[model samples]
Target: MLKCDFQYQHADFSLNVELEMQQSLLGIVGVSGSGKSTLLKNIVGLLKPDQGYIQFNQHILVDTRQNIHLPMHRRKITLIFQQALLFPHLNVKQNLCYAEKWLAPSERKFQFDDIVDLLDLNGLIQRKARQLSGGEAQRVSIGRALLSSPNLLLLDEPLTGLDVQLKQQILPFFKRMKDELNVPMIYVTHHLEELEYLEADTLQLNHGQLQHN
Candidate 1:
């Protein structure tokens, strides 16, 4: 379970939201700059809230009152950014192995070969990140995150740069990851079609505040 009841004040706007959700894909939908990404950043511990708390699976990840704020890496949450930010210098195999370094020997759950097969990345393993197409790069990015074995995943408009056909092609992989992996996800997008495809429990935001619970 994940619960958030927090507020942050900006120079021109204030974001206040409260939500509770379980292990399921939760979609955050809104126009650009409606606090959708802001809320995601907070959940991932990239941004701190001025008040209230963020609890994940009963662990107090953030609590202003208790002065508790776990660092981004300590949150066990992986974020897939708008751009598939693969390291330009690294090959697909190297990028996938980077996250494995963070796991303890006993805690390492995912195997490299399994991830390559799951993401259909066998052919691209030796290719450099810069050599991949847009869709391929995104696949590598997702595979990298999965290799980390994250408890929660945040996808912030991951399809933004892709064309319609590419979006359709990659979306099934997202669904496969959700169903096969059972990893909870928070997907942020403005496109209603994406929401329809995801069929996720949704929270609507407008003007930096949640309009729907």
Candidate 2:
């Protein structure tokens, strides 16, 4: 299980979150500035909370009282934003390989060939990030994150710019990932429809408070 109880203070607002998640796709829904991103950041160790703790199973991610804050890379968590953010100069395959460098020798790395076939990224593997379409780039982005072998996956508005056709093309990959892999994911989006296809347990957030709607 993934558990977090943290409060982060920003200039505009403070975010207080207390949540527990399990081995399934958990979807977060909120408007912009509703603290959805802030909550995710705290979970993934991107933003440190002023107080409280974060724990994934037996691992203590953050405990402000104990001053135990794990760095982002050591958390075994991967976050993929709306933007692909792949290295502009690197080809698709290279981008996927980049994640391997962070893995420990004992840790498992996702097989590149399997990712290619699952995401239908064969021909585009040689193409640079700048050369791919938005949907294609997002596919590559998901491929790269998956290959990193994270214990938890955090997706931030992953379906943002895609049209209906692209959404149709990409959603099955997410379904396949959930069915075929045990990796737990937190998918965040403002539109409820985007997450319906994933069939994730919905968590609603508004102004830093969590609600089940």
Candidate 3:
């Protein structure tokens, strides 16, 4: 289970939310700048809340009152953004390998070839990050995140800017990934069609707060 009750205030906006979810894919639906990304960042430990706590499967990642905070890496949560954000100096294969060291000793769940095949990146393995198209780069990024065996996977508008043709090409792999992985996921998007595809429960946020319980 995941439990989050936090509030973060910045110069431009404030985010306040409380949620408790299980091991299922949950969609965080909101428009751009609706604090969707901000909420995910706080859960991942990038932005500490002014006063609140987050607990994932009984492990406390943050508790401002207790003065406890865990670094992003140790939280076992992976956040994928709008961009692939791959290492500019590395090839597609190398970018995936960069996350291998973070895997647990028993977590040989997915290997290089498995990921390559899963994301349909067989031909682009040796190519540089800059050489791949938008959809391809995002696929690579997802593969890299999977290799680390994250407990909670968060995606922030991953389909943004891609054309319909590109989205059609890339969405199947996402469906496959969701079906194959056992980890819980929070997919953030502004598109209603994405919800139809994901069929996950929606947690709608407006401005900086959840619209319904």
Q: What is every candidate's alpha-carbon RMSD to the true fold? A: 1.3, 1.3, 1.5
TM-score for each candidate, following the candidate numbering? 0.96, 0.95, 0.94
The digit string of per-residue lDDT tens for model 3 on 112-187 reads 7888888988899899999889999999899898888788899988999899999889878778877876778898
Q: What is the overall TM-score of model 3 with all chains considered together? A: 0.94
lDDT of 1 at 154: 93
Error at 114, model 1, angstroms: 2.2
Worst lDDT 10-window in candidate 3: 102-111
lDDT of each: 0.88, 0.88, 0.87
Output candidate 3 Cα RMSD. 1.5
Judged by whole-model lDDT over C-alpha atoms, candidate 2 comes out at 0.88
- Where does candidate 1 stray beyond 4 Å? none
- The TM-score between candidate 2 and the true structure equals 0.95
**Residue-level error in angstroms, candidate 1, position 24:** 1.6
Identify the runs in model 3 with alpha carbons over 4 angstroms from their true place. none
